[model samples]
Target: MEAPVSADKLRFLIYRFKERLWVKPLTFCLLSIAAVFFAKIIDGTPLAEHLPIIEQSSVETLLSIMASSMLVIATFSTGTMVNAYTSASNSSTPRSVSLIIADDVSQNALSTFVGAFIFSVVAITSLKNAFYGDAGVFMLFVLTCTVFAIVILTFIRWVDSIARLGRVGSTIQKVEDAAMKAIDHRLNNPRLGGFVQPNLTALKEQGAEPVYCEQTGYVQLVDMTKAQNWCEHHNACLHILVLPGDFVSPNNPVALIERTATNPTSNKASFESTEAAACEANDIIKVGHERSFEGDPRFGLIVLGEIAARALSPSVNDPGTAISIIGSYVRLFLCWAKKDEIRDKPTDEIVQFTRVSAPELNTKDMFNDAFSPIARDGANIIEVAIRMQKALQVIAKCENKDIQKYAQEQASIAYKKSMNTFQFEEDKGRLDETKWSD
Candidate 1:
């Protein structure tokens, strides 16, 4: 949406002129000057006998030559300006109908026409003396040329503008089409299947195992024989989970698993102890609730799997982090509702989650520190961040209270976590300061 750069404007101007600036202007100027001097060449010679005709006509001829010179100058200037304007407009990629309409091709055309008309008038004036001082005819010639030039320029300008507009429109349509295709590709890709891919290679390298299921919900029991068979074929361990029908709370065991020991003899005792410890941990946090949903228990399993993914990789690169954050926030609200004995209450019975009056952080200091490196890299990151922050603030004020509250809470948590992690990494010399810049 921003205007084209100065360099582009200059380049456009130069390109439009091409070789015409020097060739046309120099040729016209020299011819005009020679015509003026030609009057002297005829003076006091055998041509003096014809001096009356030449002298009488010389003034008009001189005027005509001068006009020609002026026309050349004007035409060159107009061409350069038009080229610059056209190039600049093309680069901007206007999005609005109003902006598209405002692209002033008419102005450029008018300038070009005026320049060409001036040149035509100058050239015609030089020949006026030969017309035996017929002023009306000379005036007519000049007027006709001017009108013709104007008409031609106007037509050219309109055609160019329309063509440019069409090109821009076509480009935008193509981009939109490509974006839609990309969305479709992502949605339909079999490998992804609307589910996050487990990093099986990483898990294997780390000596951890992943479990997969097609049906919804957690497994209540694993047929050991079947599990072992599957594991042997896939070179993986079997993961088991208890279903919700089983009476289990956050304080009860939800699942048990057997892992291949790293050492057969010396680690057998340690491996048993480790497995027992893991089972105890799972028992402590198992959800204790009746299965309210009729079908697809895999939904709950997927949710739990996603949560585990987030626990493993708590960063922006991890897709699970955003989901986990939102889910956790929702869970927190649910816990609050339960504590207030409003868990079964209708929507109207719930208190409106209004936005809290909170103090704004002093962003000036943060911007100063954050953007210093950006500035060094020849950018205005602070300016951009400040603009974005201001826009967000305005949006928050206008948004629904619940939405605003959720956004604010999420932002605060993300920022805090990011700062804490950054500090920890920096202290541990794990962060490269050079990489952080820009």
Candidate 2:
């Protein structure tokens, strides 16, 4: 089924918002202020007489303690997060920093501390100003106690997570999880909910006009539903030329718009309509300065390869990390290969967007994006080479013929590279003997 354009936009917006460090803190701060004032609503209620009398001094002392302690904790937690981010960037690829920064537990812990501080300050100020009656004070006390309980729980959980937040293994795991998500989505919607792109030469020969964008950046998303709607209304078909992670500029066409029929001698009104539709086609595709993982499965694989390359560099001779990354590649490919098992038969005729054409992520491209760099960088390391060969052999056994072919091809390439670089004859012989069995 075709996903709505608004849904993609919304999900992307939410993802972008999550990457910002201040968003959660700001939201919590606002909610804290609201909570403090909400007690004022119960000031004149008849239940005030039944509510227990809470001493003002006790509340004042508790608020003071909370205000002071929370400020210190929030500042400390922020510094710790910054250090963890730096460690992740240094140990792994810098791209992994965003994943750590977007950690929900860390963000929630910081937000809670900040919110508690704000709540205490506001409550203290309101108490001094005599803003609350007996019942209101009691309600404020209850909220304050609940806030303390929450802070304690979040602190404990955050401490446990922060311990491994920036370690190399933790960073690699995060990247793998992200890659798994992207590959799964790609497998489920191979054509991104559109029909396979027809022949570009044929499309061009049929007078399909290219749609160019004014901005230069990577193509982050293509709104197929919008393109389908525009095509249906304008009596045209759209062929998307670029997928997510593809860099584009004004000189490069993002898609080709082909008209079903032409009226060369159309009136001025029709000409203006055609011009308007051409402009709308440009809006259907989204371009951004950076590649996003949401729409690009290959981006994750590329990042994982980068991490392994950095590990294999002379400064960081961590062959173990690189070998672990090889395992990750196999796991990701296995997840992708499960698509063949999911479908009982071929789905060549299953298409949701008849008017839109988009390309699918090719298996060769996936293997090249992920394994090529690792193979080139770690070719001489016997341990890394052996692991890569074994990983590929395991992948070659999967049911998907395309995956098997690519796996074998990558294995052969890695083997040749290792053979040329190995210092000893024994190492080469050992690698040669590690081939996939029949």
How does residue 23 of candidate 1 score in lDDT?
39
List RMSD in Å for every model shown.
27.3, 3.1
236-313: candidate 2 lDDT, tens digit per residue? 788988888889999988888887765566422222455566678888888899998776888889999999999999
Q: Enumerate residue pairs that collide in model 2.
A: none
**Top-TM-score structure, candidate number:** 2
In candidate 1, which residue pairs get closer than 3 Å at backbone N, Cα or C atoms, i.e. clash?
Answer: 64-126, 67-122, 68-122, 71-119, 216-297, 216-298, 217-297, 217-298, 252-283, 253-283
Encode model 1's per-residue lDDT on 1-438: one tens digit a residue: 112233323432343353233434355445434443343443345644542332434444544544555456455545654554454344322222222222345334434444444544544544554532334333434444454555466666656654554233332332233223322322222111111223444545665532223234332222223333333432234333333223443343333333444544442233334444444334322231222111112222222223323323324233332233233323322222222232234433331211101111122322222222212221112222222233223333432444345434433333333334443444323212211211
TM-score of each: 0.21, 0.94
| Alpha carbon deviation, residue 210, candidate 1 (Å) | 50
Residue-level lDDT for 181 in candidate 1: 36
lDDT of 1 at 331: 33
